[model samples]
Each structure stands twice: as structure tokens, then as C-alpha cells.
Target: MISKNTIDQVFETARVEEVLGDFVQLKKSGSNYKGLSPFTDERSPSFMVSPVKQIWKDFSSGKGGNVVAFLMEHEHFTYPEAIKYLAKKYNIEIEETEQSSEQKQQEDERESMYLVSEFASKYFQNTLLKTEQGKAIGLSYFRERGFTDETIKKFQLGYCLDEWDAFTSEALRKGYKLEFLEKTGLSIVKGEKQFDRFKGRVMFPIHSMSGRVLGFGGRILTNDKKAAKYLNSPESEIYHKSKVLYGIFYAKQAIAKEDNCYLVEGYTDVIQMHQSGIENVVSSSGTALTSEQIRLISRLTKNITVLFDGDAAGMRASIRGIDLILEQGMNVKVCVFPDGEDPDSFARKNSQADLQEYLLENAKDFIEFKASLLFEDAKNDPVKRANLIQDMVSSISKIPNQIQQEVYIQECSRIMDISENVLFSTLSQILAREGKTSGVQPKKAPAMEVVRSPEAVKTKVDELFELERKIISLLMLYGTAEEEFEDMVLKENDKGELVMEPEIQKAKVFEKIFLDLQEDEVAFTNERFRELYSRIISLLNEEGEVNIEKFINGLDPELSSEVTTLLMEEEQYRLHEWERMNIMVKTKETTIARLVGETILALRRFLISQKIDDLSRKIKESSEEDTKESMEDIMDYLSLKKVLSNKLNRVM
Candidate 1:
């Protein structure tokens, strides 16, 4: 277990905006920052981060939390993992109590697989750097490829020995389980024998965005026609090729800095591009581009430039990925290298400036590039040409943004020498076909149903608005003020006659609001809201002043988002500074007291109105036998109405 002191230090040192900014692109909005929701697919900004509060919230998804909570949600990390991540990011030294071997053995299967993968990575690195054959083979290969020793170490490049079962024996001897080794695809087991899966191959460790080794890619050095030249770890609980992008863990910062990502095909393509000074490039490792992978890049940036080899097959495959990228709302550009030269070779021949300039001059939008490439083949055959047009229209239809689709459609029409009307008709047909097959009904009815009766909802909404405003007033102003109030009580005299007596008591408005909430048996609509209210009340009671900044900082993201949202929303009515000065507006303390009192009264009135309506219904339905019960309910309702009326009059 990590010490509480260390956890506190991590939280104190790690800034929420700085940490989340690595993954999310934030633009300042008033006192907070807004960005596209990372948790959901949307173009508009709805995710908010409050620097003052040190927390974030995705209003669309209702996921909010502090820095630790954000990591837990965003990365799917455990509590300890989140703490460790923050610790590492902030360069805090962590001291944890060591777990016993038996206790450690009780870890869950997923964690065990992670441990096994990590251990495999370290063992491979050790073999490559420590052993004679590994040095001559793996290190030499990397050096030949122009990978600096620092780069090699940074990427953890390693090699496996040629001897069968070399890795398997070492892992088994180190207490790692064979089941996990096989599960992670590090070891292959057949009949009664087991051997390393990537024996004699240089290892490329593929990592998740958080830098956990999810799997590996191995390259064979020998010229065995029967053996595959390149192999990847099979899909496991921790690794999915379609969902994982190689080099994202290392390239995220660069991608964010440049606001663009360079997409390549193979493992070496990524390494070579990085070594050649293009640090923002990543690879699909020759797998088909997937929506999941596009989204991973989309989270970092919306612009991607695909680097393709000049071969015909490579061009066709590269074209296939463009539509998927567009579907994820990303802007894609294609750059085809010289014939027979891939990204690795092409990048090696040019400086960063020249290579970047080449990409810029050659990069073409997907619609323009695809239409130009396919236009030649379709020139003689009108039917093929129409089919190509349909294919372009299909790609355009997948784009989520209507404006983007329209622009692409116009571009396609102009380039293909087709009329805008004809292309639009084709787009319409494609959309109609998709709608029918996918069962996507029109959204008109659902939108209409959301309309509510203005008059009926206005009263409730106004009541809530008034209450919220009053609460804010108290929170901001009279959170520390004490006031003297008269309390009425009944007492028996010596003659046993009941006498009304008045007692004076000193009480703070913050205390009054807290007690009133408890007395009314009312609860907040949300748990986080309730917790924050309770905590604020506790702070006010103990210190006489509530530090809004400090309170917000301590809250988890969800509560922090709610509190920030409440605090930052502009009031409908604003008193000008000069006008307020002339009138000598109520002191902060008095204003808070009045606001709290008025809010309670407004809520009481709303509740009383509801009760009156319920009692009226009961009175109409009651029979003679239930007359007494109905009468008692009616009296109670009348009493509540009187109290509400009195409170409302004071507030008004």
C-alpha cells in the first residue's frame, strides 16, 4: 500500500489541466476550459475543466472527477495504478509496502497478464543488451537502421535468442506462469513441449497510450521461405490490433504539439520516421485501418496524413483507410512516396524540413486524391465511372458533419465533371439505402416529444432557479455571518396556564440553512451535490468562513464540475457597480442570510402547493367513513399553505 502522504503529494503536485491536456485539446471558455468530449463522439465542446477547482466534467456523459478520478475513468486504471501514473508524471517518489509472495499470487488474471507482459519486455531488453549474440544480431540491426542507442533504450527495443525455449525457460524459472506466457502469445506450447514464440527475432513492443506493454511485433532475420517474415502477438485480453496503434505512447506529445499525426504502414516505418525527426508518426503495423484506431488518433488530433508506399497494392489499401478516417470526423490527407520506396527509405533520404515539405506539397484531401486516382481507370467505361462516382458518394455519406459532406460532394462533382444535382441525388440514394438497411428512422417525432408545457413547467423551473440563486448568494457572501433572531415557544406558568414566550438566539445563516435542510427532510437531486452541500455546511460550521477555492479543489471531478457550473453561470439580472454603490446594496453577510432564508421559503412554497393539490384530489375522492382522515389531511395542507404564504410574502 502506498502511504497517504505520498498520494497527497501526487495530487498536490499534479495539475489537472496539465495532466488532462496531454490527451484532450482544451480551449479557454470564461473561468473554465471547454473541449470536445473525450468520452463520447461529438464535434461541439461539452467537456469542461475548471482550473480553479482542479477538476473536470464531461457534461454530455455526466462523467466528472478530480485528476485521479479522470485517469481512472479515461484510462480504465485501478486506484493504485492512477496514483502511480500521477506519481510518475509528477516525478514523485513512492514508497509502498511490499506484498508477500502469497498475497501477490492472489492478484486477478488481467493484472497477472500485465505482469507477465512487462516481465517479458524486460527480459527481451536484457537479452538484447547483455548477451553476445543478442548484441551482434539485434543491436547491430537497430544501429544499422539508424536507431540511436538512446532511441533504442527509449523504445525498449530487444531481441530473443535463437535457441528454442530460451525465453520460456527464463520466464518459467522466474516464477512466471506458462498459461500467461501462452495467453500473451510470448510462448507457444505444443503437446508436451513449449518454446519462445519469437525466438531469434528482433522485438518491437507495442504499448497502450499509458505505456503498458500490450503485445509485441517480431521480425525474422533468417531467409526461411516457410516462416513468416513478420509476426505479431495474437489478440488477448490486453491487446487488440485494431484498437491499438503502435507508437502512440511515444508519439502522443509530438502529435499534440504539431496538431497532426503522420500515419504509416509498418513497425520500422514508425521507428524510421521518428528517428528521421518526424516524432508524431505512428503505424497500423500493416493491419487494416479500423474506426477504433482512427478514434485513438482523433482523440489526439483531427488531422492525419497517411504515408503510403508508391506500390499499387499499397495505394489501394491506403485508399481503403480514408473513408474510415472521414467517418470518425477526422481530416485526412494522403502522401504517396516515390515508386519502390516506403516511408522508411523515403524518410532516410531527406531531412525533416525536406520530408515535411514533400508531404505538404503532395498531401491531397481524400475526395480529391481518391477521385483523381480512380478517374483514369473509369475513363473509357461509363458504367465503371458511375460506380466510381457512387463509391465516392458512399465515402462522403459516412462523414458525420453535414457541412463537410456537402463540401466533399461539391468537390467530387466538380472533379468528375458531374452536375451537383446528379451527385446530390446519388448521395441521397446512398443515405436512403443506409437508413432503410440500418433501421435509422427519422428523428422528427422524438424531438417534438421533448417539448413541454411552458406554463406548467415555468413555476417549477422558476422556483428552482430562485433557490439556486439564493444558495449561490449564501455560498459567495454571508457564508460566515452570524445573526440574532427571535424564537417563539410555549411555557406553563405556576397556574398551569399556557403562556407564549420569546427567546433571542444567535445563529449563523450558514447554520440556519443547514438546519433548515435537515428539518424539511428534503434531499438534493444528485449525490455529489448533496455531498458537497454537506461538506460546505461542515466547513462553515467549523471555521465560520468557507474557502470556495479550497472546497472546490478537494472535490472529486463530478462534484467539482457541478460546483463550478453553479458558480460560473451568469445571473439573469445584474446590478451595475455604480448603481449598487449609490443604493448601498446589502452587505455580503446580510445578502447571504436573506438569500438562504428566501430560498428555503421558496422551496417550502413549491412543496406546499404540491401538497395542496394532492389533498384537494383526496378530498374529492373521500367518502363519509374516511371523512375524519380527509379532514385532518386538509387541515395539515391549510397549515402548510399559510406558512408558505407568509414566507413568500417576506421574500417578495
Candidate 2:
């Protein structure tokens, strides 16, 4: 675990604008910066970052928090991972406290796998750069492929010796367990013999979006016809090929900046593009694209342009991915390289400006690409052309946005030189067939139960809830402020008439709230509020003044998020600087006594009304033998409710 002092230092040193500016292109909007939300697809910006508050809010997704929360949401980082990222960015050294033996044993299995993968990545890189054979064979292969030393080092290229157990023996000698080595697909063990999996191959480390090495892909340089040319690590605890896209860690910022991503097929294709100054590109690791990979890019940008190698078989295999992208509500385009060239070779052959210009001029929208590719084969045959038209409609129906689907349908009709009515009818029939075969059933409506005075009861409950929230806010914001509170004391005089005396007393806000609630036997109805109430009172008793920032840091994420939300509720209004406009707004400090008294009176009245409701229900359901007793209880509750209602100036 990270030390509290280190976390605080990170929070204090890191600026929200500086951190978010790395991933988002923020434009100055008054006191805050606004950008398109990284979490959703939108044209206008709804993501706002407040430097003064050290927080950000994405109105599009309803997610808002401090700098750490932005990383957790956008990068999918854990709390400690986010803190460490900020600390590194701000050049603050992190200090982690030592854990107990049992605490170390209880670490998560996923984290252990990540640790092993990280260690193996460093091991492989060291082998490539330091060892003699690695310098000769591995470094030579990458250099021959037109990769500079800078590129090789940036990608963390490496090599494994051709011997069976060379890498395995060294790993075990370094105290790494055999189980983790095998689990991470770094070693293969059989009986008493253990061998390296990527022997005699140049290695490419595949990284997660947050720059953790998840797995490796190896390329064999040998000319052995029986050996596979390329090998990838098997699925492991931390690496799922379908869910990861290579080069995403390097490409995320560029993708967000360009509002577009170039999708290729191999790791080398991604590396060469980045080396050529086009950083907004990722690869599917030579696998057929999946919905998961498409969704990954969708988080950064809404536009994807897939670059094909111009091979017939490869293009045929990649055509299915187009519909998958469309199904995710993303705009997709297709760009093919020259007849004999792939992304790697083409990028090397052209200057950066020429390559960028070629891409911009050649990229075709998906509707046109689909129609042109399919039209060539069906030009001579009427029957085949009919099937082609249906295929186009099927792809169109996969789009979730109705307006986009209609636009594509019109484009398809124009390209096929067919009537729009015919295409629309075909699409409607396909949709109906799909709906019928989708196994959807009409849901039965639930029966409604009638309740008495539900609105009145709900309004009363909501008032109490608001009062509870105010009480908690006071305790958290100003629990130690001392103030004068008037006490109501009732006594019987000599004439047997009741008289009331008001006594003034000075007490802390927390003490006053605690005694008032206790006198009325009032308890919070919400579980979280109740827990906070008890904790606040306990802390006040122990330390007199609660250090809210320190208290929040020690809480779990959920509770901490709730507390931050409460504190930041009026952040926008506070940032407006109303005082500069010569407008004076009353603050909580000036009217805390009135606020506390009103809140307590409202809460007590609500509780009394609830008691009356419960007694009324009991009277209605009472047995004949218990009817009289129930009625008496209802009468007492009614009188108490009337008295409390009078106190709050409410009509019966």
C-alpha cells in the first residue's frame, strides 16, 4: 500500500489540467477547460476540468472526481496505480509502507501475474541489449528490417537464445518461480526438462494502455519450412489477445488528438507507422478484429480507418470487421496500400508528409468501399447482384443509430443504381425477420398496489432525507465551530400551569447536533448517512476537530467518492465568484444556528409522522382482542404528531 503522506504529496503536486492535457485536447473555457469526453462518442465537448478544484467532470457520462479518478475511469487503473502514475508524472518519489507477512500473502493473483510479466519484459530487453549473442542476432535482425536503434529500444525488442533451456535456467536462477514462468508463457516445462518458448526469435513486447507489459509476440528469422514464422504468447491470467490492441499505449494520445485511429494488422505495422510520425495507429496483432478491440478504440475516438495490405485473402478476412465497427456506433473507413506493399514497407518507402497525404487522399468511407468491392464481382450477373444488395442492407441494419443507418441506406441505393423504396423494403423485411428470430418476448406488466397518501408520505420522507444530508454536511464541513444554542426547558408552575424557559448555552456544532438528535431519539434512515453520523461523532469526541482531508484519504473508494461529491456539490457556483460582481451571498458560517435548528425540527416532525403512519396501519390490521389497545396507541401518536406539526408551523 502507498503511504498516506505520499498520496497527499501526489494530490498536492499534480495539477488537473496538466494531467488531463496529456490525453485530452482541452480548450480554455472561462475558469475551466472543456474537451470532448474520452468515455463517449460526441461532437461537442462536455468534459470539463477545473484547475482550482483539482477535479474534472464529464457531464456526458455523469462521472466526475479528482485527478486520480480521471485515470481510474479513463485508463482503467487501480487506486494505487493511479497514485503511482501521478507521482511519477510530478517527479515525486513514492514511499510504500512495509506489509505484514499475512498482508503480503493476501495480495491479488492478477497483480502477481502483472509483476511476473513486468519482470520478464525487463529480462528480455536486457538480453537483447547487453548479452553478446543478443547484440549480434536480435539487434541485427531489427536493424535489417529498417528499424533504428531508437525504435528498437522504444519498442523494447529482444531475443532468446536457440538453446532449449537457456532463458529458463537463467530465470529460475533469478528466483522466479517455475509456475509463473510457465503461466506467462515464457517457459515450457516437461518432466525434468524446461525450455524457452521463443527460442531463436526476435521479441516484441505487447503493452496495455497504461504501459504494463501484458505479453510478447516473437518472430522466427530461420528459413525452416516446418517452423511457424510468427508466434504469440498463449492466453494468460493478465493477457487476453481479444481485449488488447498493440501500440494502444503509445497511440491513445494521438488518437484523441486526431479524433481518428488507423487500424493495421501486425505489431511491425504499428511500430513503423509510429516511427514515420503517424502515432495514431494500433494493430489487432494479426488476428481478425473482434468487438472488444473495436470498443477499445471507441473509448478514445469515434472514427477508425482500417489499412489493408492489398492481399485478396487478407482483405476478405478483414471485411467482417467493418460491420463490427459499425455495430459499435463508430464511423469506419478503408484504405488499402499499393498492390505489393504493406503498411511497414510502404511507410519506409515514403516520407512522412507523402505517407500522410496518401492516407488522407485514399481513405474511403465504409459504405462506398463495401459497394465498390462487392460490385466488381456482381457486375456481370443479375442473380449475384441481387444477393450483393441484400448483403449491403444486412450490414446497414447492424448500425444502432437510426439516422446513420438511413444515410447509409440512401448511399447504398445510389451506388447500386436501384430505387430507394426497394432497398428500404428489403431492409424492413430483414429487420422484421431478425426481430422474429431474436427470441424476444413481450414483458408482462406488474400489478399495481394501491397505497394511501403515498405522495404526502414521500414528500415528508424526502424532507427528512434532505435534513439528514444537511446535518452530515455540517458535521463534515464545520463540526468544530463553537456556537450558542438556545435550550427549551418546560416546568410546572405554582398555579399548575405549564411554563417554558429558554436557556442559552455555548457548545461545539457536533456536540449540539449529537445532543439534539439524542433528545428526540432520531436516527438517520439512510445506511451510509447513519454510518457517517456515527463516525463523525466518534471522531469529534476523540480529536475535537476532524481533519476531513485526512479522514477521506483513509476511506475506501466508494465512501471517499461520496464525500468528495458532497464537498464538490456547489463547485460551479463557488467558481462563479459572485462577490466580484458586488453580490453578497450568505454562507453557512453566518447562519449555522438557524440551519441546525430548522434541520433538527424538520427531522423530528418527519419521525413523528412516520410513527403516526405505523400506528394507523397497526390499528387497521389489529385483531378483535387487541383492537382497543391499538386504537389507544394510534390516538397517542396522532396527538404527538399534531404537537410536532404545530411546532413546525404546518397545518393538520
Candidate 3:
């Protein structure tokens, strides 16, 4: 567990703009920053970050909060993981508080293993850069492959010595536990003997999305027939190859910004392309792709452009990954290099612009690419051609969106020279056998329509919901503003008649709202509104140290979504660049005090009118004595309503 003091220090030191700028490309927009939504793909920028408030809101995805929340959302990090990441970035020493022995041990072991892996990564790099053997063999091997020194370091490329105990001895001497070193697979422990796992090999450290060293992939310099040409860290507690993608930590931002990922086969392919200024690329490390890896890319972008080597057999063998990607509802394209070249060699042989041009020119939708490539092999054979059609339909069936499936089926019909009816029949058989709904889903009323249907009825519950939402929005936007307010109170004067008296008081907006609601003894009808109101009042009372990120991050998902929606609701209209039209807009910031008072008054009038209606109903339903009593109560409530209405009218 992290202490509150550490969290406070991190919040105060970690700048939202600086931390987020590393991932999202932000440009100044008025008093804030705007960028394309990192959480979703969109041409226009709907993501806004407020430097003053140290908060971010993605209007497109409605995921917003302080910097830590961004890390948690973007990197899928746990709470402690996010804190430690920021602490490391800001160079803050993290001081952990005490926990139970079992709990602490569980966390300590995982962290210790991570530390051991990180240390081993650095040791290998130092050997590659600083030692004679690593430099002569490892660094030379990389540079010979056209990897620049900068690119090498950026990827944290390293080399392990040939000596059996070189890495093992160093890690043990540095006080890394033997258990952790063995568990991380950096050391092979057999009986009393231990040896470095990647002896005499250049290392490629694979990192998690948060940039922590999860594992390593090593390639041998000399082709030893007895040993594997390449070695990867065995599956461990922290590293699972299926869920990890090489260069993802480096390529995540570029992938999101470009809205496309270039998938390749090997580490060199990724590094060469990155060196050639194509940064939105990652590799499966020569392993067959997995659904987990595709979903990992799906988090940053919905479009994937796979770069295949020129080997025809290998390209066809890798088509299984396309189905996994399609199952996630992501768009995929294929880019096969020239017959003699892979991504690495091709990138090295061309300029950045040329490489970019080649990718842009050759990349094709998966359907077209598959059809053309398969059609060649199926030439002059009807059976093979039928198999090709089923292949296309099978891949299309993996797509969850029915509309996307229909479009792909139509395209397949044209490309395969088959009728649309046959394609639909094949699609139906595939879906029915798989227990999925038939592909033809009839269109209903759009969930979002331009206008409401005329037959739809309106009710007071809708008005109450809006009024409750308005009060919460006011608290969210301007809870800390301090200003004077006029409070109207009904009192009996010397003439024995009811009269309205106005009293002036100075208080914070939150204080005024809290006191007004308390005086009215109001109970919010909406569940979320009631909870959020209590939370805001609590924060406002905390000596104005209102941390919006902490406030939002502390909430559950549903509540967090509600808060982000409310926070960004007002900014939605302002984002249209309305000021460019030469129309001077009056902002609510200038009149928060009045707005707060009017909102309270309007709510009071609604509540009073509701009460009067209840009493009016009783007048008709009760006995004569009860009717007279209800009539008197209604008259009194009507006079109070008059007073409330007059005050609200003046504000209006």
C-alpha cells in the first residue's frame, strides 16, 4: 500500500500536460489543450486537458480524470502500478506503508522479480556498450544490420557474455535474490550450478505497455546447430509472451496517433522500420499471433496493417491471426514486401518517404489481399476456388458487427465472382452452425435520433432529472467560488400576515448550496445525484484542497463515467471553435454566483409546486374536514410559491 503523503506528493509534482504529452499529441486550444481521442479513433480532436485543474476529459470515450487515472485507463495498470510509474517518471522515491505479512510478501515477490529483470536488462546493455566482448560482437552485429546507436539504445538492445556464469555471478553479487533471478529465467539453476540463459547472444528486452522490462528475446551471433538460433525468456509470473508485443511500449503513442499499427515478424523488422521513421510498428517476436496481442493493439487503435515478409508460404500460414483481429471488430490490412525483401531489409534499402510511400501504396484491405493471393493458387480449379470463398466467409463471420459482415460479404461476392445470394447462404450456414444470429439484422429506430417522435409523452420526472443534473453540474463546475447570495425567508410580521424577507450572506458556492438544501430538507430522487452531491460537499469542506483526479479516480466505473460526462458536457459546445465566427460568447464563469442562486431557487419552486399539487389532490379525495385542512395547507404553499417565483423571476 502507498501512503497518502506519497500520493499527495506525486499529484503535486506530476504535471498532467507533461505526463500525457508523452502519449497524446496535444495542441493549445483556448485555455486548455485538445488532441485526437487516444481512447477512440476520430478525425477531429475531442480530447481536452486542463492544465489549471490538472484533469483530462475525452468527450468521445468519456474517460477522464487526473494523470494517474489516465495511466490506469491507457495502460490497464493497477492503482499502485500507476502511482509507481509516475513516481519513477518524476524521480520520486516511493515509500511503502506496512501491510500484512501475506499481502506484503505477495506484492514484494512480484516487485522483486521485476527489479531483478530490470537489473539484468541494464547489465546486458552495459556489457554491450561498455565491455570488450559485448561491444565487439553484440554492438557490431546490431550496427552491421543498420541499427543506429540511438535506435539500439532506444530499444534497450544489449548482449550477454559467452562465459557460463558471467550474468549469474554479477546478478547474485549485486544482491539480487537467487530465487528471483531463477524465476525470471535470467539464470538457469541446475543443482548447485547456475549459468546465464542467453550466453553469447544479443538481447532484445521486451517491455510492458507501461515500459517495465517484462522479459528478453536473445539472438545468437554464431549459428550453433546444437542450440536454438533465437532464445526467449520462458513463461514466468510477470512475462507471458502471448500477451506481449515487442516495441509496443515505444509504438503505442505512434499507433494511436496514426490510427494504425504495422505488424511484423521479427525484432529487426520493427527496429529497422522505427529507425526509418516508421514508429507505428510492433512484432510478434517470430511467434504466431494471439488474440491477446491483437486486443492489446486494439486498445490503442482499431486499424492494423500487417507487414508480411515476401515468403508466400509464411504469409498464408499467418492468415489465422487475421481472424483473431477480426473477432475483435478491428479493421486489418496486409502489406507484403517485394519478393526478395522483408520489412527490415526493405526499410534499410529505402528512404523514410519511400518506405512510407510503399506501405501506403501496397497496403490492401484484408479481403482484397486474401482474395488475390488465394485466387492465383486456385486458378483453373473449381474445388480450390470454392474453398477460397468459404475461407473469406469464415473470416467475415468472425466480425461481430453485422453491418461490417454484410459489407465484407458483398465485397467477397464481387472479388470471388460469386453471387450475393450464395455468399449470404454460406454466411448463414457458418453463423447458424456457430450459434450466432443470422447476419441480416433489420434496422430499427436509430438509438440516437435527430428528434424525438411526436407520439412520445413528456413527464415531470424528466424535468426533475434535469433539475437534479443541473445542481450537480453546478457543483462540479463552480463549487469553490465564493460570493454573496440573497436568501428569501417567509415570516409572520406584526400585521399577522405572511411576508417574504431577503437576507444577504457571504459564503462559498458549495456552502450556500449545502445550507440551502439542508434547510429545505431535500432528498434527491436520483441515486447518482444523491451520492455525487454528498461527495462534492465532502471535498469542498476539505479546506479547498479539492483534487479532481483523486475525486474521480476514487469513484466506481459507473460514477467515474458520470463525472467525466458531467465535466465535459459544457465543453462539448465550446469545442466547436465558436469564437472564430466573430460571435462574442458570454461564458457562465462570469455569473456562477447568480447561476448557483437561481438553480437553488428554481429547485425550491419545483418542490413547492409538487407539494401544492399533492395537497390539491387530497382536497378532492378526503372528507369535508380533511378537505378544509388540505385547502388551508394549499393556500399557505401557494403563498410560499409566489415568494419563490418572484425571486426566481428577478434572477431570470
| Residue 245 in model 3: lDDT | 99
Those runs of model 2 whose alpha carbons end farther than 4 Å from true positions after fitting are 1-64, 73-80, 83-109, 436-652
Q: Against the true structure, candidate 2 has what lDDT?
A: 0.81
lDDT tens digits, residue span 410-526, model 2: 788788898767877777787788782322122247689877885566433467668888899888777888888766555557986444456889988898899999988787898
- Per lDDT, the best of the predicted structures is 3
Q: What is the full ranking by lDDT, best candidate first? A: 3, 2, 1
Per-residue lDDT, model 3, residue 637, is: 84
The 10-residue segment of model 3 with minimum total lDDT is 437-446
- Number of residue pairs clashing in candidate 1, backbone atoms closer than 3 angstroms, sequence gap of 3 or more or interchain: 5
Candidate lDDT scores, in order, read: 0.78, 0.81, 0.88
State TM-scores per candidate.
0.64, 0.63, 0.77
User: TM-score of the candidate numbered 3?
Assistant: 0.77
Tell me, by TM-score, which candidate is best.
3
List pairs with backbone clashes in candidate 1.
Answer: 64-557, 64-558, 65-557, 65-558, 66-557
lDDT of 3 by residue, 1-652 (tens): 7988888889889999999999899999878888998877789889998887777889887688778878877866778889989998999988889889998998889899899989999999999999999889999999999999999999999999999999999988999999999999999999999999999999999999878999999998897899898899999989999999999999987887688999999999999999999999999998889989998998888999999888899888999998988998899999999898999999999999999999999999999989878998896899998998999999999999988988988788888888877888888888999999874643345696577787785653676788888888888888888888876777989998777798888988888988889988988999999999888888788757467766775777678768877887767667778788877777888888788888888888889889998988878789999998888888888887877777776431
lDDT of 1 by residue, 1-652 (tens): 8887887788779888899999799987656777887767777677777787676777667667677777766765667889999998888998766778766564456678999999989999999999999999999999888888988998999999999999999999999999999988999999899989999999999999878999999999889898899999999989999999999988886786577999998988998889888888999987999999998887778999988888976687568788888878898888888888999998888899998899889998888778767889998999999999999988888887777777887788788898777877777778888782222222233433566777767433555545644565466446667776444344667996544365666787777767767887876654554566677777777887776556765666556656655553321112123345665544444444455655776777677676767867877788876867877876766665565565456431
